[model samples]
Target: MTEESPGAPGGGRPEDVRHRLVEVFGERVSASVPLAGLTTFRTGGAADWLLETSDPADIVAAVRVTRALDLPLTVFGGGSNVLVGDGGVRGLVVRVRHGAISAHGTSTVRADGGVTLNGLVRWAIQRGMAGLERWAGTPGTVGGAIYGNAHFDGLMVGDMVAEVGLVDRTGSILRVSGSEMAFGYDESRVQHTGEFVLWANFDVAAGDPAKLRAAARESLGFRKRTQPLAQASAGCVFQNPRVTDDSLSGGVPRTAGALIDGAGLKGCRVGGAVVSTIHGNFIVSDGAATSADVRTLIEHCRSAVVDRFGVLLREELVYVGVFG
Candidate 1:
């Protein structure tokens, strides 16, 4: 749909979009807001219109309001796994912040979409819950995790999901079974349907809180030792390649980082963006990087890998808005 009014001159005025959003969100809606602070990358321009809310009802209402105005909508969770454009985004950008969580009976846990994955892991552990403790240092909110079927150590968040409450593009809410999500490696039904996750139910098992906490600490320590958590990056830049030819690897591990490292692309730089030496799969910013710089660097790495090995890498990172 177009964010333009046929009746207005010069497509629609920005004020018109803001006015309609203000009607629905009052002072919660803003204009020309900087977006870099919301993402893990800490790069990007601003949103022409922005809405921050902690209510699931507000998300549904925002959908209706934006639809009525014929404007586009972009939902942001904890702002990990995304690269917003330097030119900024048009229309309304909604940031979900509702993070209420609860436990039902013995083994079921319900959490709002805005709850951080790490937070959920902690909450589950404190209650002697077993399943989520392994995802201790995972970034992003529950909604974002569900959207991408966030995985770690061969286990996907989708695997533990029992059901999810979703708000579709037309502002309709529905509960769907986990199987209906069509979750695969870095994929989900929400990516195709443009649906928003309101909350989710995870089927977990009761376990020892001490054991769960220890597992969580181990996970965190592993991340710190291997990944570039000290740098400004969007986690892993590329997804691990699926090995097709056993001879192609030559001896290196069948992983994205190993492929990049084998290709001798570590520490490769473009502008202020550099491939992290600690982890070949990560592209880090030196606090002076632009979105354009990072995008260019990513392309360079991909091209290098393609040249060295016939494998074409896939990115796990999501790009938002327009790139210039």
Candidate 2:
């Protein structure tokens, strides 16, 4: 699929590729870098070549280089809600490091993809921007948030996105509006296609600073109370189940955690992978978890829920590399 692109650069020898990359990116590029430390789960293998960049220009350049060299590439963002296999990623990994945040107007703010949702919310609140306070304690970068259409309580990150700048697999930067993104619940066009967001503009309205700060605090407090915040988990392990029978779910929303908990799988473990006692949807790694262990635990939870309630749970996390 990669080679078919029009004007795709010809394949090159390994030595030539390495020399070219070193000349272009210098010390920022490294080989055989372990990725577990870079992710929220803290349980992955290595990336073949990891390019860390805090500049959008760097991200673009890395993409262009990889494409020109005909190498496999992955755009790794905040590393939240993603599980990596122990086998590691095969080729070039471009880690987005662009973290700048600035206001374009009184009611709008622009942020780099590497900016965390937690940071973005605080930035918005400080600037009297009103739309993102609900995500005060959300995990992942702005790019990851947009990729998954991140949400909390009744608010979603997609709701406030005004525009996004993306780098296509062919290394072209394209700007598009929010609606053009094909946003859905915990899904977006980015997930379907491989386009990577470099930065985004969010639309917010005039808000009282004091009120926004208080609301942000309250939202954060709620997360700390309800989630296993202190543990190492890749956010929610599963997306909320869709069920038509309201009575089975207590006439309320049917969440993945509730279903798993109801199936009596909380604290169920396979090696270091255990369902979080506080939130059944999360599988926390106790510093010794393996990709296989987590996969087994998730399967156990899925089977139990399906056996008990006839509902299939979808995963919210994306897995990179080869899964056993």
Candidate 3:
């Protein structure tokens, strides 16, 4: 039956939807799946249905079925930089797990969407490929990295991408060149258009393996030292404010952490969430933290920074599911 018509036996009951999906996807589909364990932040309620699959075919199938059923769908990768709500997600959440990579040459590699940014960096470094060395500790999958134009130390993942493989809204597979990606500050065309990245080819450059490894190590070390890597935080809470001629910060990119620190928000706490003393940009959860706690802390910091510096901070973290 088309989405316009109710499904068999139950007239489009949610349970009927789950049962129909089970017939198509088998054990890969789960109900009321707890979400906190799936994310880096380790907080949230659950997903009504979770499809865990390493097969691109399965991913596409899940997407197609959900669209046909008119069910809300969310694609979850190495969950980071997102806060799932306390009330849980209403429909289907497809969790990608197909992390495979292939080296085309010393200067090029291909990666599946589920491959972590850190994994791609290592793969390239191992093959003596350069250009991704500094993203060693960046969280999230290659798909997410591309979607958000993940960056560090003046370098961006988009710079290395040659092309992307995606499943569009209509479930057709297609390829788009890097130029067409329309990458910008923490944003990409895919993010705006709702295309799901399946894989990508990254064009790197030849480099010394030892040097690349050393560079990766140095970058990871710096992140570990400054950020609360051991803590339950969703990376940076806000995007760094751009510098302008009339900006409060001098004409250079201002760090979000510095702004929060300058605003005296470090160690500031609300519920089980606290801005990291080591790096004010991160709001580490104290295990018992709820989504509300994190959201409140984030808002408090945003407001405080605005009040103190007269510059409004924009959140880098995206909200998932629902919350109060």
Q: Poorest 10 consecutive residues of model 2 by lDDT? A: 1-10
lDDT ranking from best candidate downward:
1, 2, 3
Name the regions of candidate 3 deviating beyond 4 angstroms. Answer: 1-11, 249-253
Q: How far is 144's C-alpha from truth in model 1 (Å)?
A: 0.8
The local lDDT score (0 to 100) that residue 49 gets in candidate 1 is 77
How well does candidate 1 match the true structure in TM-score terms? Answer: 0.94
Cα RMSDs, all models? 2.9, 4.1, 3.9
Pick by TM-score: 1 or 2, better one? 1
Estimate, for each residue in 1-324, the C-alpha lDDT of model 2 and write its tens digit.
121221122436656766777888998788778898889899977877788876788778877888778877777777878899887776677787548999996878999998888888888888788988878878778888899998788677888999999988888899989999999788889988888888999998999989999998899899899999888899899988655654455443388988889899999999999999999999999989998899989989989998987778889999996566
lDDT score of residue 158 within candidate 1: 95
Residue 87, model 2, lDDT: 74
Once model 1 is optimally superposed onto the true structure by TM-score, how far is the C-alpha of residue 63 displaced, in angstroms? 1.3
Q: Of the candidates shown, which would achieve the greatest lDDT relative to the real structure? A: 1
Candidate with the greatest TM-score versus the true structure? 1
